[model samples]
Target: MHSYGQFCGLAKGLDVIGDRWTLLIVRELLIRGPCRYTDLCTGLPGIPTNLLADRLRDMEREGLVRREMTPAPTPAAVYALTPRGEALETVIAALGRWAAPLLANPHKDDVFLPHWLVLPARLYLIDRSPRQAPVRVEVRDGDHRVTLEAARGRVSARVGPAEKPDTVIIGQTPIAWQLLLGKIDLAQARKAGLEIQGKTTALKRFGVRPPTKAVFISP
Candidate 1:
């Protein structure tokens, strides 16, 4: 951990979260809700065990995260963000908006996580509907499902099954992102073997107007 002896707030803030992957750990916790120790390890592609443990410990000390004993059907120790930590959502949203351009072209070795799309999806979602009836979208990729809700002039996405989804979009992350951004159309996405069902018209609110020419990324 890099310690800044200065008394400034930004420096003080960074002292706790400026470590290489501390904020990202917060990102996982925020996106996934309460997570087990192993869940953090799995969600983060390349984080080492010791480092993850250390970060969690440091965060707990800094009043960012706290351990809880979940009760009932699945009683287990889990980590959830404190209110102070939940405050980071706005920070993360701002960071994601700032970093959106870089996502246009990812580096060869860049690590990718499907749930990472949650923040940006919330950020970039273009809701064209006049009436906000609380649309629900389930982004399904393999065994992972991210629930998205767009209503009340806000978009919120959660990592898990939805209560009752109005539209279920099943597709690869990259293609789905592109489709949602209007870089591709539903037809093209379906042609690529995606399985989308329910309220197709309402689903268009999440995507941009399809481009005239489809842009394909080479394998």
Candidate 2:
């Protein structure tokens, strides 16, 4: 609850989200939208359970989030951003843009890539397929959305469950970064016996074509 003098908007805003963990928590919610406590903990590595609980409580008290009961008999609740909290999305996006180049390097430690990619993946539709109708993939330790249904050759990307996908992407490292960094070409990776399986046409739809003018972090 530290406060800056009344006149400084930036300082006052930081008063609510300036704590070590608060902005990180806010970033997750902003990127992933509503999430359960478990999701938060899973997505954020190294945060202790007790500290997370305390931060959530403080966020709730500060009106940055609203906790709503789910339909489960055990009375589970999900935390979602309040209007005030949602307003931070722009700030978060700016931070991501600023940090992008610092993360693009392949030789750097990959620990932060997952968190870094989450927001931009959502923003840029990096996992989405425009050429196919239903392309579903499940990251072993990632969030679950819904299954996708596509014809043999159409572009789409769905998260969550599927019988099997043409190409199953698996990594804790930023998939987007891996694609962009030239560490591995999708075709080359597949040719070298990566875990790809299914129609080649379907797989082709997941190609990475990052914008030519974008800045990225160097190793």
Candidate 3:
């Protein structure tokens, strides 16, 4: 029962997805495509189950999502965007562009390594370039392992064991983030005693360039 009243078209659009969590939920679907409830919950940590369920129901009623029962004997459901919902991708992408500056500020001590980078690195593809296929990567620290694949301007990551890749990047989360962001050079990180194992060529391949100028935002 959400209504825009006399708001402008853009304001009316926001009325449908203006809530904080709603836009984020749409962002995930737009980026990753169809997903199960569990997957959505995993990507969006800290969301309460009851609230997520309510949002899903609301979105469905609003024509932004479509749900289908899977063919499993016990039957599970998955959700995907409808055409109207899919149109939101452009808006979400614009929001990301606007937020990029805030994302680049290095002074924020609250910055934490995005879980997207770690965890199930084994099942993912990491691509630093939009033009190149994702270089395969395998990450291991103790019993944890994650694999990555990148191709066609997309990256996919999964968790599990596998053969070591050409490079093995080892560092605490903060240093890792800095390295990834180009705030710290690989040589500097190595001199600081961060472990960089595996093939030297692989190390070079995995070295991601930091953005020239970051959009500064408070975390």
Candidate 4:
């Protein structure tokens, strides 16, 4: 709720969302859709409970979020973004793309969730073969798994096993990223503890290719 007392658009926007953990809250809602308070806590690692409650209250007042009561056997309250808040998708996507290189070397203690790869996967995996059948790539890292699908010149990701995967990539998260982003070829990724099965062409269809000037290569 802090403001710079300015009338500019960017400044005005910041007045609402520039607070710590604010946009990340938006991120959770964006990725997870309507969810309960407990769901938010799971996605957000270190946010204090009181701070989350306060932020939710402030966001509600500002018309960025709304709470809904579910009906029936599993009746419960859920939180979802208002249309106004949903409009921040472009801003979040742009920010994520701008900050992608910072993911090159994660700290050892940094927490990671498979669902988080959804955003970056959509950003990077441009389908090169729209005419072909959809390609489903199941990525397994440690105990987590996510499925990335490419069809009609776009890609989408979700956390869980794919119904009928065209390809399966098994590796630690870092190695998996390197493979997906074309930082390493399949052979190199295999040497680095990565494994692949099923259709290798699926990777190519998902835009995994040799590093080139046109591609955003991580440092």
Who wins the lDDT comparison? 4
Q: Lowest-scoring 10 consecutive residues by lDDT in candidate 4?
A: 209-218
Collision pairs in model 4: none
| Sort by lDDT, top down from the best | 4, 1, 3, 2
Candidate 2 per-residue lDDT over residues 1-219, each given as its tens digit: 577767788888888888778888898787667889998998788899999998888889999998998786777778999998898878886776666566445565434524444455433334335554665543322443333233444323333456765444443334333443355677765454344344545433443335522333323
Question: Which stretches of candidate 4 lie above 4 Å from their native place?
Answer: 208-219
Query: What is the per-residue lDDT of model 1 for residues 1-219, given as tens digits with 9 covering 90 to 100?
Result: 678999999999899889988889889988888999999999888989999999999999999999999998879999999999999989887776666555556567776667876766666665676376888888888888888776766667778878888988887776776766677678998997778888877576664322222222322
Cα deviation at 187, candidate 4, in Å, is 2.4
- The digit string of per-residue lDDT tens for model 4 on 159-190 reads 77898899999877666776777768998989
Q: Who is ahead in TM-score, 1 or 2?
A: 1
> Which of the two candidates, 1 or 4, achieves a greater TM-score against the reference?
1
lDDT of 3 at 178: 51
lDDT per model, in order? Answer: 0.78, 0.60, 0.60, 0.82
lDDT (10s digit) by residue, model 3, range 1-219: 366685599878877898658876786676566779998887787889888888888899999999987787877888989999988867765565556456555564554323334421211213556575346555444444555555565555555444546556564534544554456777887875568766544333333323333232224
By TM-score rank, best first, the candidates go 1, 4, 2, 3
Superior by TM-score: candidate 2 or candidate 3:
2
User: Could you tell me which 10 consecutive residues in candidate 2 have the lowest summed lDDT?
Assistant: 139-148
TM-score (C-alpha, index-matched) for candidate 3: 0.63
